[model samples]
Target: MKRLSDHTDVQLTELFTLGDIDAFEEIYNRYWLKLYSAAYKRIKERATAQEIVQDFFTSFWINREQVKIQTSLQGYLFTSIKYLVLNYKRAQAVRNSYAEILLMVNNSFDNSTEENYNYKELLERVETEVNQLPPKCRNVFELSRKQYKTNKEIAQLMGISEKTVENHLTKALRYLRVNLNSLLLLTFLFLRR
Candidate 1:
């Protein structure tokens, strides 16, 4: 009797596709550690790497029927993990950038009394400017910036298309940029000090 381990990956994959759970188990056992190590090397976070590898396996099983492997299974898994790591890194970068923007906005004024007063005045001006926007544009900008809704979600909520929501946001931003140029310049200079 040939042990499951004696079979090649292609053989095991065929068996797995045929609903042989034992063959799947053997493949999992053979590749799990290697996959984990590959993920760890790229991500450099133990927990995140573990989660990525585990998620890949879960997705692999769930999407097994739809998955068509042209290369070896090992190559396919490695490529999948590589793309996963890249996506994770890209998302992390976006979050980091958002955090930095929030920090800059929040910390624009220091504890100085004059600066604090200026901050209040600036905020009021910004609020007034936002309120002066066209109703749809203001609503879309508020939902996107304050409520943090995606364009698609804003479109659904407003009964408009995503393109319309995008246009509204663009219009609001352009208006604010033109109207509040000096305020933005002051804020930038203040932050630079």
Candidate 2:
């Protein structure tokens, strides 16, 4: 009696379709290495290539009855691996994009919420000076600097002349600049110790 290994590819296919385990085993033995090699050449990852080949065989066996071999089983399997590699790459690209976006969002959030302690203290000092301004001057400063409103927009909202808006902004900026310069000098002296 001839061994299943000696059978032709056509004979193995027929036997395998009829649920012959020995014929299936022979086909697996013949093609497993070739299939794994094809997968690895494309994916370049050992474990993932192994899994693709293993899954191909598992599906081929499970769907034997429904499988139509229009061409050789070898061709079918290599084609399957090509599609699997393409799909894996596509999935990885999508995941990488989402990871990048998430990283950008996290970095922006950190920059806003985790500012340097000394910088936060400097901002607090500026806020104290801003509160000491006359009410109209404080409102103008908050609108122009904090809310990012233009001089013309502040004049329109506050029912003041544009010149008055400009004067208030100039006064507020000059006061803050002088105070900030002195604070910076003090900070420099303290750090030198």
Candidate 3:
């Protein structure tokens, strides 16, 4: 067998497009470190940088057959890393903005007796509504939401089918929405502060 390391980028790409795993591995091994370092420099976070580079390579391999390399493979990979970093930064900004808003609201609520009372009442009302759900529906909803289980996990734990779990969740949500719309609206308003 020919050594993949001896092949040029264009040849590797062609081989990869033709479903050559060795060529694909050669391409990944050739570029992963450079791409990761470039991403890390831009992001300044090791884990996030690693994830971005890993995701790019995964997508590259997955789309190898359809990918159009308008420039050199090096140029294509670098440009892909650049765009991935930009997108990661943009998403991080949005998440930070939301975190700031939540922190501000939580800090404000810390000293407000009226807000605390309203929050307590809202929690009580939610509990009441949840309790009012039919037995199976309540169990499924609690497992899915409170325990944070996936539908499949809930199904396995409860000895029910995933479809049944989904049905219960849908029914529980509809009941809650109808019964607690006002409470939910009030909670939303409080959080919007």
Candidate 4:
């Protein structure tokens, strides 16, 4: 009865790479719970933590044949867990977007002064950023924002291909990201203020 914990990480990886299923099982058994605990500590949600750890193992198993262990197994395992935790955090970002979009959607009729102010602030910041775009990007962003034009519609209006219009919009967004941080902070402060 060999103890999985007693085996060197290199030996475990080598054994796994040699198509030994039991050796791979041993590797998984040794690390899965430990990895799960690491994830759980960050997220405090069992389902998300479970999903993260599960994805980590899935990636490792899927690439087991070609998997090269350049670092120690502990390093590789922890690195995978870190990526999974980051992904889990990112997916939850939609919660903020959805809440803002919902406020924008609902404020149309209720006409609360606060909500209306927030909507106007969001629009003003967006407009300011859009105005600062280069000519081509400004034109494309305007068609899409003011006219509610689809990418195809905007492309046709500009006599450019849809791909070109998409590229312009992409660049426009990149520019806004670079330029709009202060405006975004002001807008957020106004909404919360």
Q: Best-fitting candidate, measured by lDDT?
A: 1
Per residue, candidate 2 scores C-alpha lDDT tens digits across 1-193 of: 2389789899999999998888889999999999889889988999988987887788789999998988987787788878867765654453355346335333433243334455567568878988988999999988876787756578889999655876787677667667766876665465445
- Native RMSD of candidate 4 (Å): 10.1
Per-prediction backbone clash count = 0, 0, 0, 0
**lDDT by residue (tens digit), candidate 4, 2-53:** 5566777788888878876767778888888999899999989998788778
TM-scores for every predicted model: 0.63, 0.55, 0.60, 0.54
Clashing pairs in 2: none
What C-alpha lDDT, on a 0 to 100 scale, does residue 147 get in candidate 1?
96
Candidate 1 residues lying further than 4 Å off, grouped into runs, are: 1-3, 112-186, 190-193
lDDT of 3 by residue, 41-82 (tens): 999999989988887888788887898988999999999999
The lDDT per prediction is 0.79, 0.75, 0.79, 0.72
Q: Name the regions of candidate 4 deviating beyond 4 angstroms.
A: 1-6, 111-193
Model 3, position 143: C-alpha lDDT score: 81
Q: Which ten contiguous residues of candidate 3 have the minimum total lDDT? A: 93-102
Model 2: runs farther than 4 Å from truth? 111-193
lDDT of 1 by residue, 3-22 (tens): 69989999988887776778
Q: Quote the lDDT for 59 in model 4.
A: 62
Q: How much does candidate 4 score in TM-score?
A: 0.54
**Cα lDDT for residue 18, model 1?**
75
